[model samples]
Target chain A: AQTVTQSQPEMSVQEAETVTLSCTYDTSESDYYLFWYKQPPSRQMILVIRQEAYKQQNATENRFSVNFQKAAKSFSLKISDSQLGDAAMYFCAYGSGAGSYQLTFGKGTKLSVIP
Target chain B: SQTIHQWPATLVQPVGSPLSLECTVEGTSNPNLYWYRQAAGRGLQLLFYSVGIGQISSEVPQNLSASRPQDRQFILSSKKLLLSDSGFYLCAWSSQPNQPQHFGDGTRLSIL
Candidate 1:
């Protein structure tokens, strides 16, 4: 079974600063996908970024980026120029390439942007 | 564009009462559907996933069950609700395995 771990329970960043949320996963499959999702107070689960295992390049979406180290099984999310809207619960997820649509999610890290 | 809808937006039920939550996707066919629950500040816990009609997979044994009667519709049901069942229920859909899933606003289920 695949499991995702988020070490940080809560993180705080100043407005316009940068913050990183760490994530690690345990999986035996060689091919898979990783994702970062955001949920605000509205409780809407939003896709922040995604990274394919086969890709060596990291994934970046606007102010959000991921440092994906496949060998280390670590996928960390970085938020630059953080705004108040960035405050939410961030979750790291893992999915296998073998037609397993289910995503194993980390415990989640609550991000707070201090204005 | 594809969109997923889950209703009702919020639900409150008494303990031992029957519960039903519905999820439907639009502009897609044969897509994979999933049900997840989030407890307060915790991460999503996958409850069930369906690959096709009448094909359902359970990830945890609890007071809940899921069914897929239509290609793009998924339903979560429980004969008797429990206090542990209170959480934000999310419905998501993906075109294929390993693809990014789009989620609905989710249903806030409160079991009293």
Candidate 2:
């Protein structure tokens, strides 16, 4: 079974600053997908960004970018120009590229944005 | 565009009462559906998944049961509610097995 690990339980960043949340996974499959999901106080799960294992270049969405190091099995999310609305619980998930519907998730990291 | 909908954003039920939560997807066909539970201060626990109609797969043995009556309709039920079952239940769908899942707003179940 694949497992996702988010070492940081909690992270804080000042407004307009940059903060990175760390994530690592244990997977034997070479082809897989890594995702970052944000859950706000409303308890809605929102997709932040995603990275494909076969792709060497990282993925970015506006202020959100990922540092996907395939060799090290590390996929981290970097939030630049952080805003207060970014405060939420961030989760790291792993899924196989093959026909698997399961998404292994980490406990999650609580992010607090300071003004 | 495809969208997922889960009913009763919040629900409160008495102990031992029967429970049913409905979820439906629009503008999609034969999509993969899933049911997950998020307990207070914990990560998401996948309860059930279905690849097609009447093809439910249980990930954990619990008081919950899921059914896919139609291609885009998934339902989660329990014979009798348990206090331990109280949590945030979410319904999600993906066009394909490897695609990113789109989640509903989620139903907050409170068993008294």
Candidate 3:
């Protein structure tokens, strides 16, 4: 079974600053996908960024980026120029492959952006 | 663009009552649909998933059941609701198994 782990229960960052959320996973498959999802007070699950196991350049989406280290099974999310809107419960998720429909998610990390 | 819809934004039902939450997708065909439950301050718990019409897969053993009567419609149901079933029910869809899933606003179900 594939499992994702987010160690940071809570994180705080000042507006215009940067913050990083830690995430790790246990997967035997080499070809898989990793994702970072944000759930605000509205409770809407929004996709922040994604990374493919076969890609080594990492993935960046505007102010959000991922440091994906496949060998170490670590996929951390970095939020730059953090804004108040970035405050939310961030989750790390793992998917097996192109044919697997199961998405295993981590417990989650609550991010608080101080204005 | 594809969109997912889950309705009755908020629902309050009595214990032992029947439950039927509807979810539908538009602008996409043969998409993978999923049902998830989110408890307070907790992560998402995948309840069920479907690959196609009439193909439903259960991820957890619970009182809830799911059905895929149409390629774009998925339903979650329970013959008798339990208090523990009270949570935020979310419906999601993805173009493929490894793609990013788009989530619906969700249905806040409260069992009294």
Query: In model 2, what lDDT does residue B38 have?
Result: 97
Quality of candidate 2's docking, in CAPRI categories?
medium
DockQ of each: 0.87, 0.77, 0.86
| Error of model 3, residue B70, in angstroms | 1.6
Residue A88 lDDT in candidate 3? 94
RMSD of 1: 1.1
For candidate 2 chain A, the 10 contiguous residues with the lowest summed lDDT are A46-55
Tens-place lDDT digits, model 3, residues B2-112: 888899899999999999999999999999999999998788999999999999999999899999999999999999999999999999999988999999999999999
Which parts of model 3 have CA positions greater than 4 angstroms off? Answer: none
**lDDT to native, each model:** 0.94, 0.94, 0.94
Off by over 4 Å in 1: none
lDDT of 2 by residue, B36-97 (tens): 99998888999999999999999999888999999999999999998999999999999887
lDDT of 2 at A51: 86
| Candidate 2 Cα outliers beyond 4 Å, as residue runs | none
Best-first order by DockQ: 1, 3, 2
Residue A113, candidate 3: C-alpha displacement in angstroms: 0.8
For each candidate in turn, the TM-score is 0.97, 0.98, 0.98
- lDDT tens readout by residue for model 3, A22-96: 999998898999999999999889999989899899899999999998889999999999999999999999989
